[model samples]
Target: MRSPQGVCLFSLNFPPEPTGIAPYAGALADGLSKAGFSVTAHVAHPHYPEWIIADDYGQWTRTEERGRTSVRRRLHYVPRTPRGYRRLLSELTFGLRLIFDNWRYPAAIVSITPSLFATALVALRLRLTPNRPPLIIWVQDLYGVGLAEVGEGSSLVQRIVRWIESSTFRAADHVVVIHERFNALVTQELGVAADRVSVIRNWTHLADPPNTTAVQARRQLGWPADVILAVHTGNMGAKQGLENIVDAARLAEARNSSVHFVLVGDGGERKHLESLANGVSHISFVDPLDDHDYHLALSAADVLVVNEKPGVASMAVPSKLTSYFNAQRPIVAATDRAGITAEEIFAADAGLVVPAGDPEALLSAIQSLCADEQAAERYGKNGRQYRDAVLGEPAALAKWSDLIQQKFRDSNQN
Candidate 1:
């Protein structure tokens, strides 16, 4: 392995992906370039939430952009199935296309994944290239757990996928996990060498504070002044356990019909969730907001809530929690605190924590926060201060620059 004068990032998601990692990869690419390493982002056509390719990228093979850094778009199949099987095919198809697309622009391979279907391809690419730049596997979720949770395939299929996942982890020059719990999962469950793993929290998506008053923002968004609004914005997947929110909403509506529960995002389960909330006057759903509007919409919330299914604790460090923390709003986290979700809110003293999937607990915490306005404001302000000091742009950018540089040096040493 040898270092390049530049770093190339291979990520499936990019700018229009509308998820946490899209912006993160973009930021890293930009940061690496500004830190004196030329950067290229190899990304698939952006189609997220709805799982259909964006209308703007129609029939185009590739496009280059110079916003944060040089971005290279590649075409990949967008799965039309809800089953994880077709999704796996889509991921593999993208990886195959990426291999050919990146063939001439050889550099170190720093790939990310929840898709084990592509792990073997990436591992084989690195293994075959004797002078390959180090392959750093940036892990967000464990493929073994994720596959099982999503019901992607059968037991035998998962076993094979797990083998692929293990092979990639074993072959990778460095394995970076997002949290300490994940690092432990690698060492204890996957039997990875302790020295090969590193833990780094992904930064939040807090942009400039939206220049709108809470009242004005609420009015503009068609929200009422009397209701205590609880906002949930992110992926709508089974792992989110959003049903708990519906249950909590029912309980809250029973207590004070004025309280409103707002869901502001798209996901696999969103339509079903909407159906369940059909007759509930207090439940509201809105189309996904653009980045700027999203920030402003969050400002109107009295509390932010995040829910994770049981056993999904270490599998994912929910990226939305960072934005919630940075929004300076009290968080009602229905997730394990061991993950970054708990760490951010608890450390900042910004919100209350409850066990995952417990509607009653979520209801109680929401009630507690709503009941005490002064306490909620204090917690929210402290959270903003904590985010600025730790997870803000300057700190996040510096840390990302250092790690990419470290990867550059680590590759050279290898």
Candidate 2:
């Protein structure tokens, strides 16, 4: 069935991209379509964690039906800078490529962030076309801050990108941020009006019942029965302050031999992290697993980790918190700014938040749970309750569907 309003969703990275936002985009597309909105997802070929294009997608031209959603993939340049510069190039190319690809369809648009180029281009098109549909710019990561963190671009380029990003934010008919802190940044830093912006918290997909039997999971991963399993799943990059985790592992080992730390997933800092823990028996490094396996690993973990660099508050919001919440495990967030995720976790009594990059603090938080089984159970239950109440798939879909359809209706009147 054709949609009442043609709403096209554009994202730099979509499904098979091996990260949070991609899958989130794909899911949103499916959800929006099921709500009776015609959804066409425009994205670049999958190429994330590895920084190279995925082999299966070839150079270009891949399409799939995700429920009622239509996904269109296109070819774009992937840089070899091995850091932020390459990522900037990827976003730029995908943005430019999508302009033509999405020209005729999609009466309204919603864009995910850090893809400043994509958002800016869509904003520009809307500005130029008087009768064009309204655009919603979803701010996930603040682009200017993220680029500087990874050591990308010249002062001039950073200045220009910031300009483009700010202009895009201003251009959007509505700007949505994942948390209150980010919403404030858009208003104070970028000068977006409070009335024009909304704080839409991120949500987790409805999770399956926990695997009551992790005997298979434990056997497959060789997790020791006696050891306290501490797992860090997600990107292994500089921004994550993974070295702090390695140091925490050392401290955990020094404090208790039975506490084991496992690092799963790959990124720019993988080699250095592996090298640091080379001879260490307590800290284990495993290859990145698929979503199902990742979920299983989280369930098997005694404590889950989220970390950030010192003084890097507002630089990023870890997308893994949703997964952690869904996994219903006690989380230890080591972030300089414990924004919404940390606040909610604490309020729900689901986890402990420590200052970012402080190995001693992280070590202490992990030990708190290691020593108290009742506290762990309480925290885990709180997390599950929080997830069910706020971040579940149905809640998110209902909110998104209303917002998108409202935009579609408004666009039609215009």
Candidate 3:
């Protein structure tokens, strides 16, 4: 049977790209496909974690099947700079590349953020097209606020970028954010109607259920059973406020607690973080693992971590929390209690929350959990239960299905 005229979904990150938004984007695509929309996913060539495009992909506009959807990769720039003009250029370059990614007039254009340029292109396409298919933006990060975090809001480039962001939000028929905080920003601050916004949290993308049963994953990874392993998985970027983890690691070692800090992922700040931990005995860094190993390792850890920079509460919600919930480990979120991450963790009764960027407070919280096995176990259980209740695949997919179909009146319209 032929797939119906469906949705054009564009995201900057997709499968084959490790960390960041890839897993979330890919999961959403599959969910939409399962909802009966023929999805054509437009993504730039994979270049994440290591920030180098693999030689084999995008040799000539490669196309591949991902369940019911088809993904098209276009060669786009991946700049080496950690920040500044070059990085912005890379984002814009990919956006420009997406302009030609063709599809039937999709009932709706759904874009996941960091796809700002591509999303703007969608707005422009709506302007050019006759039907003006509804543009739906799932904002994983509010670029305007995030750019301001990096001190880019005052720049001329940011001025133009914000204008485009406003246009994209204005063009969107519906706006999705993972947190209520963000919903408020998009509605009250950005002028999107409250009724048009939806808060849908992200979920783990692993296809397989937990499988490392009976094997001691910690022993396999050389972690001592006696030591309390506090593991943080996913991107090591500025927004993560991982410097606090480094400081907390130093404090843990100085106090000589059996608690050890393990960071299992890489990104722009990986090099600098390594430099900070050069002589630290209790802190270690591991490369990103395949899904099985990563999940098993996370499940084995005594504590899972979510850290965010000071004052980043309203700007972004760490999607890593969904993965953390899947890991079913007691969480230690060293962030503002009022922030989205802390709110979720607290509501789920999943973990302990400490003040953001406070080494002593983080150390105290880790030690508290390490001392009470029963409390930690309860927290872990709570997190797993919360994932089932809220962030599970069925719930997320159902929401997307309704939203996607809502963009069109009739099946034949698109």
Candidate 4:
């Protein structure tokens, strides 16, 4: 028997994994539960930004309850170097597990992507079910766009992935995109109807930063206080193109620049990035920090950075930007000039955008900000204002709750 308010959420990542899509998906599950919906989240065992399973979770499957939310965690193959065939295997293994699992019909279903294959498989299952429930796909990143941008597989592999992605999206009763740009991409490129998409921007999930000076924060983190610290947080994946940071750090070292670069977080590309930065004194790496320390790390930076590969344009809108905004710090984005990331930084009026893959340009922007304290302060103020006005958590969550409820009501009526 299905609970009238039951909502089954399929997300590859979930809470306890601090960065990437996990936090947003976790927030949605919690928000829906608070809105009086019983949300059953079918998620993978916590293994993300750091692609290793959590130490505490060794079981093949486990179930836990958090208030009104029921979480089902399934173990999947996690590749340390998540690229090429290995990455596909990981997604396929998880998707197969989800497809074969016994499912209970719910009032509505919500699927989060980046586990695009897993979502598609479940979508196929839903299609065959009698009196199928409404499926809503919440897109955090476009798999088709990512495959093309990363150039991971061959042409045939790309086509298969795109076919799977478009089919799954079209199967959904509706799609929720995080940005307006995604609407056009979905409708035009992926063959989804315009009316089926909704845009609810992602907000900062991190708590407010501590009341501490940058000098004090630096002291606590053991970072040098004299130099200007340029921090880049979040995933060090291929799309991040963190090699640009290494190159810029090398340039700074060559010129004896006072700027120090710090990368805080881990990902598939972290090892490669560290290799590239092996002897570069100007660059340092920090493992992922807890919430309090994460915010402190963001607050301690003189300038926060958003870096992407040159070709990565519209796949995602770096979730780190929301946290950066909440930190009230000036941002310097090294991304495609016409990409969604650059557009976001421009919209927030929070930072400067430099051409992607250009280390000299990145270094120049950081130095320019360092030289102009007033300008940096102005940028920081603008960011905080934008966060409060546009990226507030209450607004985003409320919109999601409303959408889910409306969809549930509509499904029942039909």
lDDT of each: 0.75, 0.76, 0.79, 0.90
Q: How accurate is candidate 2 locally (lDDT)?
A: 0.76
- Residue-wise lDDT of candidate 3 within 281-356, one digit each (tens)? 8889998887777877786788888888876666677767877777667899988788778888988999999888
Model 2 segments more than 4 A misplaced: 1-3, 80-82, 147-159, 213-216, 253-256, 337-341
Taking all chains together, each candidate's TM-score versus the true structure is 0.91, 0.91, 0.92, 0.97
Please rank every candidate by lDDT, starting with the best.
4, 3, 2, 1
**Local accuracy of candidate 4 as per-residue lDDT tens digits, 274-295:** 9999999999999998898898
Kindly indicate the candidate among 1 and 3 with the higher lDDT: 3
Per-residue CA lDDT of candidate 1, range 279-357, in tens?
8777788876888778877889988888877555556777787787777788888887665568767788988989887
Which ten residues in a row are the worst by lDDT in model 4? 1-10
Best by lDDT: 4
- In model 3, the Cα lDDT at residue 210 comes to 67
The digit string of per-residue lDDT tens for model 2 on 29-113 reads 8777887778888777876665567777755667887778887888888763446567667777777777766445465688888
Question: What is the Cα-based lDDT of residue 128 in candidate 4?
Answer: 88
